[model samples]
Target: MQDFNGQIAFITGGASGAGLGQAQVFGRAGARIVIADVRAEAIETALAALAGEGITAHGIVLDIMDREAYARAADEVEQVFGAPPTLLFNTAGVNSFGPVEKTTYADFDWIVGVNLGGVINGMVTFVPRMIAAGKPGHIVTVSSMGGLQGSAIAAPYSAAKAAVVNLMESYRAGLAQYGIGVSVVCPANIKTNIAEASRLRPAQFAGSGYVENEASIASLHSIHAHGMEPIELAEHVKAAIEQNQLYVIPYPEAKEQLRRHYDEIVDAVLPMEADPEGARKRTEALRNWAADRARVFQKSEG
Candidate 1:
């Protein structure tokens, strides 16, 4: 997994933002790159940027939510590269903000489908292939700081990202035995076009039309103006992959926030009751759960 030279990388959302940053960095490391995005023009522009730098890369117009399309894209990638990608980045995402009461079904579906469902699709489409190839590989899925902490204004987005964080952790435990390392990236604000994601929502998922809140959009943009550059974050991702780290947290303050969140969860657990029999039974049950999980892993790796 540490090796990047001559490897193949399949990156979603690579038209811009962090995905594009990864393509640039990985391409420089001599990895063959496949940049996939729903926006054709953006993909063209991204490929052109890489081409200008003399990086070996190509683009595929992709919508990760489409299962059939994702399968076809996987096929296309193998045909182009002569093998499946050794690196898979499920980095595409979108968001919408409002009170939970104001959040429509369409809004929830759109945000969740792209942010969480897309990652699920990528994992399902690629993991089996990677395992069958019997090669060392890594998977990195980009969640957000908001995933660790819920946001009232962006409930659906936060919920979806949180799910991705948990999903990746589970995948990490199961895939480690198969030589497929998994990492979930929980990044804070970065200079990206996520605030404008609603504009790119496909018509099929646009249930209720979203009216952009200019003031909030402006505020988000202002904050992003001072955020970390995408390339710097991408470098951190590279280091995390090389080290086989589970979590790629770029913002320094995020560690404190996460600690506080964990502390609150710990505090919520009530003191154990003075019942030895109950405690013994609970311990046995938990032991059984762990054993079951271990057995599943062994069965897969056997």
Candidate 2:
């Protein structure tokens, strides 16, 4: 892990933005970069940029939500690079802004599938093989500041990213026994095209009065316009990797929010009382609601 020279890095969503920035850093550190992206043209552009910088990199068209595609990408990376990649960066994600009541099930599915499920798929498809090879490796899953603390208007995004943060934490604990390192990044806001690159709602959801129209999208763009640069966030990621840190938060403001979130949770916890079954039932009901919605979406898609 200390040495990255000649190592291989497999990065999802590496066509542009933060993912591509991370690729550039890894490439500069002498690692062979395997960049997977859903956008064909963007991947080509990224590859060209890396080549111009004298970095070793290859691009593959990938949809991280597709398990078969993920597996095939891993195989292809090994075939082209002659070894399993030592680094896996699960950085693909999308953003949607609206009240939970106005967010359609499709929106939730797409966000959760790409943001959280994608990271799970990457870990499942890559981590075991890395362990099997008995080589030093690292996995970095990109969450967000919203992952640490809920956002008022981005419920689906917050839920999905929070899942990623927890998943990476669990993976870190388990992987430590196997000599693999794991890092989770919680970026507050970065200048990324995620809002623009997001897929449009299907007609069903578009007409359901739950989709974010042009105005909302534009508002989100305005916020991103004021966010940090991808390169600066990439620097934090690289530093975390070098230091073997488990959590990487690039924004100072985000650190304060995380502290506040923890304090709020502690404050909300009340002393145990008799007949707490009602509270437990309410929690279970919420869980079941989320699960039921997820199931309905999967069934419809299937």
Best by lDDT: 1
**lDDT scores of the candidates, listed in order:** 0.90, 0.84
Any runs in candidate 1 off by more than 4 Å, and if so which? Answer: 207-216, 273-276, 289-302
> Lowest summed-lDDT stretch of 10 residues in model 2?
200-209
* Candidate 2, 66-131: lDDT as tens digits: 899989998998899887889989998887776777776777777777788888899999987899
Measured with C-alpha atoms, the lDDT of residue 276 in candidate 1 is: 70
Report the number of backbone clashes for model 1. Answer: 0
Estimated TM-score for each candidate: 0.93, 0.85
**Model 2 off-target regions past 4 Å?**
200-214, 269-302
